[model samples]
Target: MDNPGSQEVDRIERQESRAQDLHLDRVVATQPEIGPTPPDGGYGWLIVVSASIYHITVPSLLTLYGLVILRAIRDEEHEEEESLKIWDMDLALVPIIMLVIRLLLESWCRAVVKIFNMPRFMALAGLCLTVAGVLLSSYSTDTYSNDHIVNVFAGIFAGTGCALTGQQTDVIITHYFREKLTIAQRLVRMAPSIGNFLAPILIGYLCTVYTGDVIVMIYAAILMQNCLFLASYTRPIYIEKVIRTTYNMLRDAADDDDEVIYSNPNQPTPAPTTQNPQQGTSQDDDNDVVVFNSRKNAREILDPAVQYRERSEPVNNQARFSSDFSAMFAETSSNRFSSNFGSLDVINYTSTSRYQELESIDRDSQNPQPLYRETTVNAPQNNIVFATEPTAGTIRRTATLKKNLITIANMLMDINFYLYALLHLSTTFSILVLGVFFPAYVWLQVPSQTIWWVATTIAMGHGAALCFLMMCLVLPQNINEKTRLCAAFCFVGALGFYGITISGNRSFLILWCMCASFSTAASSILQQPLYNSTLNEFDTTATITTTNAIVAAFVLTWALLKNYEYSTCFLTAAILQAITAVIFFALSFRRRR
Candidate 1:
């Protein structure tokens, strides 16, 4: 009783719907599963402990060498007319070299990861290099005629090693402690202060007993402790990437079908036809999938209204699709889908269930739920074992490099970043000046017999600063307040340094040390506010690299100067501190405006 044309149309519609459903099922099946959620505590705490130990040991050497080892070297090599200058310059280059190496590694971190796939292996390599550098330096002191050149070689090794170790620690910490990251960072930050407090006293005492070369060997031995701790850096439980490739492919296919059906109203919807596998036309379908998946945010994909609005736009189908496809996937051919029929676009495929759970948790933040849920054998769980399976695919190194360059350029363009960088440079310069010259100043002021007392006083000052930092963590402070406090501390420190220049009285010196140490510690704590106020996009690695480079430049300039006199150095530091205080005060006012 039905017309033959109508019957044909009904059959075509049913066939198309069935085909679409079948395609969606295949796409869904091909999607990569999400990995397990981070266990915020348990094993994660072990990682925190490892990172803390690293901060305490590796970074503490910087202070130890500056305060204790440098002085010992000066005494041992005192016969050389320019030994002091040469040693100071050589040591100053250590940090500069380290910064340069760190910058290079960070810039090409993706490539480095490819080369050293496992974080633990990278860390082990670093440890070996560091120990080798220290041992080499110790050997150079005794063996080499031109020890400075050898020292420089040692610096290169040490710098590269430290950078690698530090990078892996940061990566692992971030990987392990997602939810409890803030807590872990606070705990880790405390380690440096403890190291700063303890290293001076311990090393100073050892200096009384051992020679410089022997002490260097001892330090190398201590660094070996990192090997035992490296075991704590368990492989980061892999999480599935949250990619929307499957969704995008489905959306694009639907859109293409819609376009075909609507191209001419007079014509009936054509029956779905199979294309020849040998023909090159399937590349067009692959291109469509790539173009649609270019969108970054999941929210955009989830919003039905947005999709409807996009479909309504009067875009030239072939031109727009081709342009978008080229723009998105032109960087790498691997991003494109395979030419075979029914084969899903596996590029950028991510775990769905994990993404949903994380999204849901973010939405219900007020009533937080456990990250992991119990699953049954029959229940659907799309967990991917990242260790066994390649999560997503190899990231394009060139693309990442280009992106980082763009980000750095953008940061450089911002006037606020420059201000923050200057502030950071000033604070670091002051800290370095103190670390490098403070012991020498103390030695000149106090009798040789009473040097231990001065060292103890310095240690106590660091302890006081540690307490102040702990207090700052607890006390809720806005950016304005932190800036004001930093300014005040700088002023107080300037006064303390000026006090030291005027008189060498033991009691007064003790008071000055405490005041100066507290102020120095404040610089470390308060720089956070300066950074927050200035940077629109806060990148930890980039910010650190910029600040370190600035500080290194200043330190190099300082080392080049002929003035090694304790009084002159103290006066210069005081003047710089006062200038920094004024700058901070000005910054605070500008922020208010």
Candidate 2:
């Protein structure tokens, strides 16, 4: 290395080569002519933390968890006779419809984000909606025959809050810490686990000890209100400091260095004005001023152009080197980088969550293509968590669809995402319609029917769990592995449970659910990883959803339409598994190539 002030500018070439080996080098960054930074830092982490807690506490409470107990509106509730009748098929869809509506509404909210960049306002709107929604739910004991109507209202409030808060938080994190992405995101992802770990037990204890409806309502209200109040702490993300564009000025400065030529056998050469700076550095000539403040943080470091344009300061730098880095906000004003500096280009690296959000200069050098590598960082925690932008060296071929055609096609393409939901509903419906087939069938056989049913069910659940786990691992979006693993383990543990055939005769449905959920964890884990990696390759075409839908449609139709008869359901499931497993295996390998 040369003296800090005299390092060669050409060293950028070497660093360019090095970029290829870094994982970031693999992705192509989509660079708009100018890039925009998200609002980041300050209270962003607080928002993520709050959201995590909220998600953990509220979402966990369903009829199953009994976090909130319903009033005996059942006793006075007109419109229904028996409690069992009240809990019938029509009412069961309340939560499901609410969730669906919420997702749809949230999608609408996401679309409007471009118009509302104000984080504080967004957060406030979300908080208010949440409070209102819950309050409304409290009032609607038997309000509507369609359970979906009430549920949708509640879901919309919560879902929109989550979506809006998430955007604000993400932008802020991007502004604050561009480097500690992976660690920060993992912390955000930890929210659910952290909240759920104790919520269940605490709520359970509260439910057991407090039998009164009023007290139970009070407790639930308190919990919710506390969460709502804490939501304020999430805060809006902001960046006070700004770094303006200076690459052009820096490049010009480097170019002004004295040039020497050895021509016509031998020629006298002018001495060098100064060697140019390298990939992350600066140097200067009489007309140019170099600024090198190595000790300053990235945001605080004065841009090279800023230094060249600033007025000179009276203070002298120490031998060890120090400068008024805080006061060095020169923008484009001429000023020297008074502190120790080295390198050619001022890399201007920005980071988020896990990956560095930037273009790979290495790929640029190799092909020198017209396409620029670009990467965008979404600083949020989701089931999928990879950078959204495509990789470098990739040729983007976005399918140009006729608008009319796409509109027509989209209406028919619901099968992909909708198939799973359909299967779930159909499975339940089949069991109901069959009128409790298993236990009755088993009553005739006695004890032998119980063991065989239990054993087969357990085996199915075990296999299903394995399949889910594998898929999850393969899924590329890098969802929180710990959570996925925990879910997987729970499925596996559930396999130990015994079930009597629905007929009292012993059939394998309970065991079946366990096994399917378990096997699903394998596929589920791999699912995001595979999707993510392939996304880098395929962009956002219908590859994953299409494949899953095609496979699922066959499996679900066969399994459900056949009426879930234990006699042949397992055989259908086994064959479905064998075929899709092969297809998935093949698809999973594509990214590696």
Candidate 3:
């Protein structure tokens, strides 16, 4: 009798304390989830600038190797006889080596991006290797007594370096410039064309006025400058959503029908399914009905306290998993990265909102328990921001690998892939033949004025390369227009090269050489549009590999038939180009039909 009133008051006071705890816990658990901002053009443009520097320097050095060696050999009267033996045959392999390295290392390079967790670091490393290779070649060329040794070492080092640096640059640029991708690519490609245009003039001047030492030194300095630009590529920005929580709809044992109970934390989840109107329930109600009915029918479920415990327990499990994953990966405390290059403070509140809904469901059933955990997802920023954890990154990369393989497999089945491949093969073969044999062809046929014809042919070829770049830059971004131009140019190129094989007149040869140069440049330019139209990256890779293989085949075949007359080589190039034009026209016709 003395404490009955006090006991009743104490019971009410305890209930009030529990309710306050629940409210605080709700606030904590419902905290917003922050994520990385999407990439728009701020620091991304900086990447384009850096890539352009490398584009200009590296390809200029690479593409000019043949011309540089030829000029050196011709100028060195003492070595003129030996030059043909050492320079001509071996120089053909440089582009082949570089392009093959690019073709083979595509998968390995993609892995490097995932494993390093920092593309900028990988890019810097590649730049360093390129610098080292350039220095080694420069040193060897200056000191080495043997011309063969100099060409061999220089080609190996320079080719390897260009391969490494060029691949990384392409990947970085493609990652950053999605919105104005066409314009960005045109700018980057233009750099190489500019390099090709200028490299020959530079080499000719260096050989005629300065020495080989001075030429090699200049290239090393240019490549070193490229390193400064590459340093700005700090980190990669991911566009896809992070913090995905999947929920699976398990079949109900009683009904033998699918029910999304939302009971388990680890179950495989499908996206929200469509609601059945005949049930007179919304999608949300349909999802929870199974769990609601189970709680109502079971005696164990009647205990409100036990039901609350069940719901909170699952949430706690999820929180732990997320916490562990984040900690393991050394990511920002909140799954999002707050970056200066893009918008910040943006949070994906789906997880928080869903948690609150689950908590409310528990409360509605008249079940109450202590919200034991604070459930605060600590929001700390990182200087080096990556999109995912190591495990998640690995899984995603593995999945991407599977997708690439499947896509490649599908392309193998597609007739269009082979058709395009053949067209690229023959066209690229023709284009490379110009660089490989045209200069030599001019030197041989017009020996009385070798210097003039060689210089003019090289100038016109690179001049056409520059013009092609400019056209792609200025033209409307219409695929049909590009296709029409490519066809017109290629047909003209075929006619010119065939004429070159038969024509002996010096003036006519020069004119036809210019025509072939323009057509080859235009044909090469068409590849950019073709790759852009492709649905898969692997398909682009396939086209590149096919083109390189065909070019390599031509180079090796030429080496085997070294005894063949120069005219025979020119005739072969013309035949291949003519075939390419036919295939392209046939492909275009089929597409129209």
Candidate 4:
């Protein structure tokens, strides 16, 4: 016969066990679904190809403004002083307005992704808008009267399209490649440089052959080819839906009940099990076994005891338990158990302490007993059922939204991230300001015979820079070092701009163009890697939007200053680059100390 004290202990043990099971059930029911692992290769290469095409086409359009679009607009300008003022404003404002529209669209990219559901669809929509904008700009003949207004709308549409296409392409490429991400990024980065190198030569040649409107239409036709390439690629890899459990909360609750639960803090948290009403007994039933169907396999059972017994079986063949309670309490814990479910150990009720040492669990070696027995009955072919309550879904979405908001807020608060953004914006601002005004400067200052020679020199410089960046990517330098090197290159480019201000010699100007293009290419290639290494939590969409907004503000200030003089513009760009370089050097020095 059992002693009265023994009976009381057994009753308390049963109550504790029931409480743990209830807690697990509650946690599992509220958890969201986890996506399957990335294939990391497969059709992802095809995605890279499509993304390369997008980079080649969309971003390179901006480069054409200096060669073709701006020249066309300038040619249409009237001789009146008011017309010249309006033209000057258009030159400053067009790119700024374009950047502003792009900024706004990119900032709201998350919402756009939700609406479109896939990057391919978003790319398609952006393509249509871009083509329409090009056609609209081509329709206008006068610059001061109708073309200026039409060009603003054109910039808007083009900016919107470019933002959507660029952002969505990034998402698709990132989603596809994991292990080979660096290689893929290098290849994609190379595309823009290739485009920049080739676009000027192509546009310059086309301008000499075809009229401006004809050239615009021809480019629009070229842009339309992306639709074909995009459609050829298949959808992204299939993701398996698995429950995500909150292990920390379970651990805390276990501690509150004076039950010890063992878990490796380093191990990933495991998914918890929900009480399945269809394939298993009701909560009121006293049966010791429970069975549930996984979405991936209908015949699979999620029993920890069964999983432990078949531990020697291949991972693909083993049942995917919500939590491997048995394995968690095994003699030697392995990383295998932690991979599926977060690390967890069976509850130890003997100790009043919330956490007992692993060595203290000697009862398992002396007289082992399974936490629960498994009965393997055939599971019916049914879908993985989830909580049908509307409130649960709403609550989960609200939590996700709140978490994202907090993350963005935290990123915004970080001084390092803010400084990094300023550095990027300053570099981009100088590049744009130079690119927009450089052609006009050349036309005015350099002799007519040297203009085409200067254009060829610029194209060759871009090509050489592209090749150099490709070589740099292949080298073994770390991101931090590469970023510093790029900053130094910016300083060198600033010196190049200053040289341009001091001399109108074609040979010197050619040298300056090469330096500037080299800096531009290097900055473009390293930007993503630096962002990833510095602030992994910050969203790419948000970064682009924030930087572009700041750039637009700077451009607005320049416009208001009414400093369109070529010498002043080049001087201003050089000053901004110098400041950016100095700040980066200071920040890097402080970080090292």
Which candidate has the highest lDDT of all? 4
Q: How close is candidate 1 to the true structure, as a TM-score?
A: 0.60
- Model 2 per-residue lDDT tens digits across residues 1-593: 56754444456666766776554423222332333334344455555565555545443333311222222222233233222222322222233333333333443454454355454566556555655555545533332443556655765565455555544444444444444443344444333333333443444344445532333355346445544534454222222211122455567777663432222232234335544466443323222222333344222233345454342434323221335444333343212445423321233323222334224434546754322233332323322233456555332333344543464366345432332332222222222211112222222324333322433433343344333333332333445432333333333322312222222322355444444344433333233333443233332334333343444354334423433333333333333344443433333333332
For all predicted structures, in order, the TM-scores are 0.60, 0.42, 0.58, 0.63
The global C-alpha lDDT for each of the candidates, from Candidate 1 onward, is 0.61, 0.38, 0.56, 0.63
- Which is the winner by lDDT between candidate 1 and candidate 3? 1
129, model 3: CA deviation in Å? 3.4
Better of 2 and 3 by TM-score: 3
For lDDT, candidate 2 versus 3, the one ahead is: 3
What digit string (tens of lDDT, one per residue) describes model 3 on residues 1-593? Answer: 56999999999999998898765323222112433332546778888888877777776555445554454445554332222332334444444444445445544565566556465577767666656655554533322234455445555555555655666666766656555777776677667656666666666566566555566677677778776787787654342122122111122344453344554343344446567778664333321323543433432112344456546652343432232333322223322222232223234323333234443544466754424112212223322222443698899999989987887687677655654555465555565556545655665555555444466566666676466447666755557734445566767777777877777576677568667766665565566676556424455655555545555565556645565545665576677666666666666655541
Quote the positional error of residue 443 for candidate 4 in Å. 1.8
Candidate 4: residue 355 lDDT (0-100): 28
Off by over 4 Å in 2: 1-47, 63-86, 89-94, 140-152, 155-183, 209-531, 536-593
| Colliding pairs, model 3 | 35-336, 247-269, 248-269
**Model 1, range 186-279, lDDT digits (tens) per residue?**
6675677777788788877767777656777888898898888876775644432223555677787776522211122233344455577785
Question: How would the candidate models be sorted by lDDT, starting from the highest?
Answer: 4, 1, 3, 2
- Model 2, backbone clash pairs (residues 3+ apart or across chains), number: 101
Which ranges in model 4 have alpha carbons more than 4 Å from their true place? 1-35, 73-86, 89-93, 140-146, 240-413, 450-454, 537-545, 560-563
